[model samples]
Target chain A: MPQPDVVDDESVAAVEAGLDALDTPTERRRRFTWRRAAAVVAPPVLAIVLLIAVWQALWAAAFWPEYQLPAPAAVWQVITDNVQTGVAFDVLWNSVHRAVLGFAAGVLIGTPLGLIVAKVRIVRAAIGPLLSGLQSLPSVAWVPAAVLWFGVTPSTVYFVVLMGSVPSIANGLVAGIDQIPPILPRVGTVLGASRLGSARHILLPAALPGYLAGLKQGWAFSWRSLMAAEIIAVSPQLGKGLGAFLEEGRNLSDMPTVIAAIFLILLVGIGIELLVFRPLERSVLRARGLSGAF
Target chain B: MTATLETSAMTTAVRLTGVHKSFGAGRGAVSALEGVDLSVAPGEFVCLLGASGCGKTTLLNLVAGLDRPTAGDIALSTSRPAVMFQEAALMPWLTASRNVELALRFAGVRRTQRRERAGELLELVRLGGLGDKRPHELSGGMRQRVALARALASAVQGSQDGSPALLLMDEPFSALDAITRDVLQGELLRVWRSTNTAVLFVTHDVREAVRLGQRVVLLSSRPGRVVREWQVGDLEPSAEAAAIEEINTSLREVISSHAAA
Candidate 1:
């Protein structure tokens, strides 16, 4: 058929404009008010308060000896002293630096490993099961072996951290690649995207959620392995970390110091999650219109 | 007539001769398309009408170069033929404009020009000012329009002789509501007419085929072959209705005959 006349074009555009006006959803931007902030923030704050209250009550009730399960104030005092002396910063810096370096290395290595395994049939057949197995194995289990190989040095901690994270990161990528709808790659092929172009533009982006989830898990593993390595491989060269601090508290039989160290560990874990992964996940999911509460 | 024929041959968008495609080998082998011969002229609007299991999609894949034909020759004037799937297939991570831009990027458009070109394509699809919206943000019909824009972006500057490229659409509007489908059909017609791109639209909807196609080819089921063809050029409304009814009757006969056999 010939092209529509000018009048037809005008009317068609009018009709389309009308259809679009009706069909397009109105965006009601939910303003983040103080009330909304409180709604989100109050629960966690209240939970911590409630826990502290319970701990105080337990202390008052004398459920355990003061030396065995130190008072909240004693633990608080220990934390304050560490902060005041700048020891807390040193401990956190040591642990965080190792965790970041190890995780970064894990990402660099795991990404290509995952890509190779995901794309190459022979590599997948050879190592797919092994990757899954490694993800399940506790990184702490590698601590003794890592110590034996690298000695009681920073390398031992890093070796343990890598072992903990690499499998999770690589496996996460593989899972992400696997979950991609078959039609997506076909669409890429039809669009005439070269293999590398498709990987960059299509495959990696499609697998982002899975890969992010893997990174989060990998971080958790890295932290855990670092702690395990530090606790076991106690050396003067490896400056005191949170795990070493906790071990020191144990050796000194100081309940307050031990509790303070444990609290710092928990605080760091939650802080990293909130500061890094949660926002990353939220943005990624929101962009994809999958931001509904899970 | 001889001169016109020569021109047609030179300007052919795609041609498939004795094209055969099968799924597997040995006892498990299932043929999808067998000895299929077809040709699409430049700037033609052709619809392939067939029931489920007729290998309409397989034929499109073969032509799009996503898959090779098991046997026989499939030739295209352009190496990169744009394709739109049933689903919009817009990258979830990309906004509507970015999705279109990605296509332009692949089509070898310079980075500096991609954003502007993507915007123009979006405007061509009547999706102007909604380029920043992601696929999930847009309504189903709107997403399909974005997909249409992306397809158009991929087609731009595709033909070496500066002619329009081919677009293979596989039931792109089948997933939409009737009202949305109607709107999109009109939009598609407008786009096709303006761009002068050859489109081989595959669908089972006879009404849609008659509504949009300059020519409609019917395919037989289970190892699909072209069973019939209809040229719907320059028909009046009443005559178009009559043509639709005739095609529907023939389609029913084809389906029933297959059942009986």
Candidate 2:
């Protein structure tokens, strides 16, 4: 027999270290810096400034009459007036509180509903198409039926928000569950995980990106549905929300207040997406090495 | 079942008796393996060789308890066998040591001991300092090493009465480049020797089977059945040129017969 070369721990370690050096990629750690922040923040701020400037020019040119297409300053003045009187906080609080409560309820209902739809074939066959159909049908259309059922109470607003949000949340979870690679569950099984154990350890974490996406979409739907309810389901007992304020402006022919309400609605929508969901999604994606772009 | 019981005195890591597996039922049924009878003794290294569609992976899956056979029986000494796939199959979201810990956890290791044991397992695979790195951060070879550590942890967990663990590997090195594969095969041998685990390694590479296995078993292609076996004796299979040539010649005959059929 040919004498085999002596195998030692030292030589193996040396060989492994050499191979690793050749193969290990030098990773560039991207630090969060002021310059990166400015790069992201600058464009949107500049766009908003340009929009105001164009509005001012249009008002100066008297393109449509002052009452119909009011100056940007007039809309700002209306917002400032509401803030001074503390009406902005009150109306903002009422709408936001309703949205938060409705979203929480939707999550409770939608989670079990999603789990059932994803796992049970018979249940999925029966209601899967219905959930998808409900998602496409505008939640605003439910406001009229909600008002008729609940008679402009807080329940009516919550009912409309739930209708808008549930389908989106459930469908998002179902889609996430569907996207998990088949190898993952098989790996779990071979590792000796039980069915429940696999779901807890493997399936849920793997499905997070999809579930988070569903939650973000569900929030958006709830907000839109709440606004529709506030505007259409009018009663003296109902607190004045941004949507209600906009409706009052239309009744009194106050264009500045109408524009102000529209701006507040846009601001709140973008704020929640930026402050809550975006950071959460970015972290989850980054942890999994799925984040390629900022 | 009787065949396994008959061999109980020597004790085995795993034994398959008259194992048959089929994919579907009725008119469209496809058989993958037929009448497969194989066994791996504790701490023995056996390589299962065959052409593509020879049901090597199907046999491993049956041994791993991932699937039931259409007929016959498979019995194992341990509660479960550790399995390694062509891909590392580590969870992307977990760190390397954490991935190893997951297997330990499933094997019912206490939380207090899991971290320390996981570290030891990583050291055993020569992945000592890279434990905190995620799967994506490691090279393909490093990821496979972590997977090896995880498999070792699983084996330790399933072992009973100081018995050696059983490991099922399905072409675990096929995806690697030549140099990495050589390094890993050497590493695997070292690990296998020190740990004293029984390994049922499946591959289509004849040279690899000869290089690693104490005994090499050959299966005919399509609805695979054991066609032949060769004992490499005490000398290294690589050094035994006559034995290597004999096994290769038999393998060629099996492939040609497949073509003819």
True contacts kept of 2: 0.45
Deviation from native of the Cα of residue A12 in model 1, angstroms: 1.6
TM-score of 1: 0.95
- Residue pairs with clashing backbones, model 1: none
lDDT digits (tens) for residues A1-294 of candidate 1? 323232367777887787777878666668889999999999999999999999999999998999897889999999999999999999999888888999999999989999899999999999999999999998889888877888888888888999999999999999999999998898888777899999999999999999999999999999988888888889999999989999999999999999999999999899999999999999999889888752
Docking class of 1: acceptable
**Taking the tens digit of each residue's C-alpha lDDT, what string does model 2 give over A1-294?**
232232576777788888888887667898999999999899999999998999899899998988899989889999999999999999899889899999999999998898889989999999999999999999889887887888889999999999989999999999999999888888899899988888888988888899999999999999999999999987877788878988999999999999999999999999999999999999999888888855
Q: What lDDT tens digits, residue by residue, belong to model 2 across residues B1-261?
A: 332223244478888889999999998998999999898999999999998899999999988888888998887887778999999999988999999999988777898899999999999988898999988888899999999999888887887556567999999999998778877887998899898999999999876787788999999877899999887646653557777778889888988886667
**Residue A116 of model 2, lDDT score:** 89
TM-score of chain A of each: 0.95, 0.94
